[model samples]
Target: MKNHVLRPLWVAILLVIALLVARKLYVPADFGINGRNFTYGYYRKASVNDWKEFKVKYKGRQYCKECHEENFDSISKSKHRIIQCENCHGPAIDHPDNPEALEIDRSRGLCLRCHADLPYPGSHRNDLPAIDPEEHNPDKACADCHNPHKPDLEG
Candidate 1:
């Protein structure tokens, strides 16, 4: 009784697999029904721009703590204390001096650079899922979920 049932199931599975293979081989790239054609375009090479004039230098985090003791004090206690502020927010030499010269960069790309399959320390082994910028807040940034100063602070 078991063999009779199993034999028919195996035969049906093989038949389905054979039909799928045949369908793939016969399908053409173009439908050719409505004179539609599919084309893929490649990117063209371009000359490099001279960005030296716009480039700025970073003076490091120590320079920030001098004036921003409150912010620096909180940040120093977080896991990111090991990480430099300029690493994520860019150079603050101008921003620190004028408070508006430069802006912070808290993009999600910076978080994924280390959090994604790319390369993170063993500490991130239990990392969360990768986020889609379009689906979520494109501007809230990683700081929305995490605080550089209070690493595991509840938001």
Candidate 2:
């Protein structure tokens, strides 16, 4: 009876020791670096090449201003100053090398994303003018009354 229980316990201890040895051998020597934990280091080693080879898609407002000074100037002075050009227009990745006119999104839904009236109470609601699209102008697009570049509608 004693031998039967001892045999299983010995096998289990040996199995755990084997697993520990295998893990130590398989794991990298420098598996942690620069305060980053083991998992981060492991993934970084696996994907470092991909990150190094990656090209930037968004070149930022300064890059856009290089060719589009007039529009950039207009946007800088307007209520929409905080909004990025690429937010309305899609990514300008290839525009610099192979120039083409970007398609503008003039949809009412796009305008309403930030301007739509929500029942929730906050100071942001007061800062941003919101209207009921259905009642404001049932069939008309927001662009009909508002200029996207300026968007103040006060002129």
Question: RMSD in angstroms, all models?
Answer: 21.0, 5.9
Overall local distance difference test of candidate 2: 0.80
- Candidate 1 lDDT, 69-128, residue by residue in tens: 888778777666777877866778668457766667766777766555423467664475
- For every model shown, what is its TM-score relative to the native structure? 0.46, 0.68
Tens digit of lDDT per residue, candidate 2, span 1-155?
A: 56988999999999999999999999876454646666563343536667888997777889899889999999898888898888888678887676675656878889888888776767576567788877889689888878888888784
Going through the candidates in order, what is the number of backbone clashes in each?
1, 0
**In candidate 2, which residue ranges exceed 4 Å CA deviation?**
1-46, 98-101
Error of 1 at 38 (Å): 61
